[model samples]
Target: MRTPPTIPAHLPRLAARFDLSSEDLGNCAERCAARVQRLADLWSHAGTPPGQVMRTLRRTAKRHSVYMPQKDSAAECINRMSDPAWWRRALRKRFRAVELHAIQTGAVHRHASPYVSAKALRRHELNAARLAAQMDGLEAINQTTGEAVPMSDLIEASLANPANRRAALMARIKGIETSALAKSHVGLFLTITCPSRMHPRHSMSGAPNAAYDGTYPGRAHAYLSRVWSTATRRAAHLGLTAYGLRVVEPHHDACPHWHLLVFTPADQADAYADNLRAYALADSPNELGAQERRFTVKRIDPAKGSAVGYVAKYVSKSIDGEGVDFDSESDNDGRAAARRQIAWARTWGIRQFQFFGVPPITPTRELYRVSAAGLPGLALPELHQACKANDYAAWLATVEAHELRLGVDYAERESTRYRGETTKAISGLTVEGGDLTQPLSLVTRCDTWRIEPRAKGQAQAPSERAATGSDFSPWTRFNNSAPIDAKGLFPSDAPRAKTEKKGEEGETAVRGSVLHRAPLPGAGRGDWESARPAA
Candidate 1:
């Protein structure tokens, strides 16, 4: 007879803790039996007997409170329970509680939460408290910074701040204005194209990838840098010591381009443009090289408010296939050619550079303060004064009439609609004829007025007809003939007059008699009809 197998050492302890009713134990035994049979099949494939597999399974399951009623069931339970799904689900249910306990107890590891030292637990709590205090302090500081600070103030301050890298730039711009190199100035946009092409290794010929590679600043970037340096040097020579410039690299069809902003005098615009072009193309020593390459420059008008937007587009754009028209065969060819050109451009030994002259460093502090004061509250009184002074009262009356006709809530209307600040309301009172002291209504009067329906077949009244010239006398010769009936001389029934007409004396003249025709009014014949109706 076979010897009874020895129970695993941990089985007895597990059985004591998870003591179950016989019926429940029997159900577990049945599940374990099925598991054992499956394990036997698996292990036997590798030449291990079912009994040996059962022995190994029994040892494994005992540690996890999994019980096997028999040797065969041991293998079955081990095979089936090896999947930790049940344990994972159970852990998920207590995840939050487990995390909290781990924090409170200063647990070092997930499986050893109950074994943390008291010192470790206190350390974690202190660290948490310190972090909370830091966050609160940060919030308080943020609140005290004030919300009314203008964006212009922030930008100006950021540029002029001593610790900022742009401090030198600020100084340069300041020098230009103070030295009288430039008077009232405007900004310019410089577009520089590089002769260098992208390396063939990175070229995307087909779809025209617009992506830029930071690792490879490319010949375009190098060329831009040289142009910037040259331009700055030239500006210094012109007595514009303080100049500010921002150079950005842009990619088109895989080739690089530079976008630049500079501040200089408006009157010297032409000179600046010429000098910039010369400096940018200065790289070509020979006629052929100079003829083959060109640098493009454009001035940015600050009044247009598009300089910032123009710069941002190239900086943030990605070289995705989105903007490309892949359907066109020419586009594909162009892209391929561009990639080759990029590689060729590299041979020119051009490098990218962006430079701008700094604004005056001294005025930065005062300017920052002025900008910081923030925009004034709606200058309603000043606006009113301006309107009165400029005779804008009629305009105000017109606006008021429109508002009334529309039946809109005037008080609730947004000031932007009228191109004014919300804090100010347009007053209905206005001066007539630009007279600040006179009311608009008193300036003009409807001395003669008539109304008529726009619809067809509406009979006009006698007064309305006279007002409309319907009952007016017509032009007639002085031969003592019956006075030409106005209606007969110009019948409404006739076809509409041609837009073009001719005059008498064989000279091309306009038709249509004046209410009182004379030798043309400007001929110096004073009131021709009053002078000679018989002529």
Candidate 2:
């Protein structure tokens, strides 16, 4: 968590003098001077190395060399570095140390606070970046396997193997339906496409078919911005309240395209397609060929398709392909070129999976899911507030108040057989909530719950009413866990079952068939994939 700003003693008077909001004070991380000094201190002679020193000197020389200070020796450099204000100025002029970071809160959870911390770590850019990805929000777990693979990897792998891509996509559709947003609202698979360039266009000198085109980002970004600005306005005219879950994918030659799962009021599905076309054409005149079928909207089927799985797959594609084109038809060379473009974009600091409107899901809905599922997780409001402010003290207070534990711990404790100390195979799991700490026992207290169990040859999920009629707690489900499809997750070897203790409900806890082991090679970090569903 960023350290909170100390409130000025005269803040009440200051606020009255110049109308300010509490959020303004609550949002402040520190007084400007402290931040300046820290970055400035990093550039000091003791702090900066020989390469930085040379770079600084070179930059200084380029900026009016004749007026350069005479401090050239190591001793003189150290003397100059002693001046904090001077280093701050040099650092700002040389690099954007001031523009620094956005400090995206709620992206990650350290022990005390629920927030993400980001910066260019010394000498470990890629590793630091990946570490930061730990804060990316959660998507649905594959219902059959209970595995939480990054959505993009699953989509790409499925698309690449055309023989099974259809089934995989269908599976993703259902998974999307299980999530908070897609479950409640009408989701439409929407595409906003740019005019296809017959050949690569360049602003600077470069070949049309150049592997890494310098012009693609600018052109793609401009087109996306233009269409998006107009599209939202059109949505307003159509009287639709829209929320989008979208992904930006690079085209074959590196131009960008969008894949979107948009949620609007549930009853608007029938009229969406016509309005979408009108929206696309509103800004694009026929003379400019803007009417070329550049927009598409397909209403999601709650029965078999999911908006979450559809859009999430595209988000995953951007990084898994490492920025290569998403098409499966590409040869090795095409794939390589795609990777290069992605790397180049990263080097230029392009954002992947950005948004143009409100996020489709809300934090309250997330917490409710955790609560309804009888899962152990964090208090939603406390976490919600912590994600807003930059108060280190408030972060510490949250940490002190809540007894946070890992999902694994919750799983073990909730196990009927393993409710005490005896060990046995582990079966089944419950994953819920967002990027930060989860509150334990939030949902277990709720009297109502609907649990869907996996059974043989079940195409349609039984109604919610039917689910509540059975014993569907983790204990019962894990004990009776059965295989549903090929997507089922299981350890390579199955374990034998044993006896267990009884719960307060007087039901005997059967030993489980699933057990936790390290994930297979290339599995997600710290994810429990070794334990497959009970067969």
Worst 10 contiguous positions by lDDT, candidate 1: 441-450
lDDT value for model 1 = 0.33
Taking the tens digit of each residue's C-alpha lDDT, what string does model 1 give over 1-535?
3311222344334434444433444455565546645665677678876567766676645643444433235343443444343222222222222222222222322222211222323433454454333322221001111212211122212321112222222222223322322245666666665543231112223221123221122344565667767776886688654344454432323235565655566777667767777776765434343434455556664456544344432222211122223313113333332222322232222332234443222211111111111122233223333222222222233334333111101122232211221322211122222212322210000011111112343334434544765432211111111111111221321212112123422221111111111111111111111211123
Deviating ranges (above 4 Å) for candidate 1:
1-186, 197-215, 218-223, 240-244, 252-256, 284-294, 299-355, 360-535
Residues 1-535, candidate 2: write the lDDT tens digits.
4421322344334324322222332222123234434544676636667566656654543442112335555334433433433443333222111111111111111221111112221112453344334322222243334543332232222222222332333333333344325236677787776553421422222223322222334455676767666766776787866655556654433455567776666776656555666655554345344565467767777577556445534543443432234444223333443343344344224555543344222222222222112222354345434323212223234434553222322222222211122232223222334433533322111111122222333222224323644212212211122111133221221122222332323121112221221112112222222232244
TM-score of each: 0.26, 0.35
Q: What local lDDT score does residue 491 receive in model 1, on the 0 to 100 scale?
A: 35
Question: Candidate 2: where are CA atoms >4 Å away?
Answer: 1-176, 179-185, 196-215, 270-292, 302-304, 321-326, 332-345, 354-535
Give the best candidate by lDDT. Answer: 2
TM-score of 2: 0.35
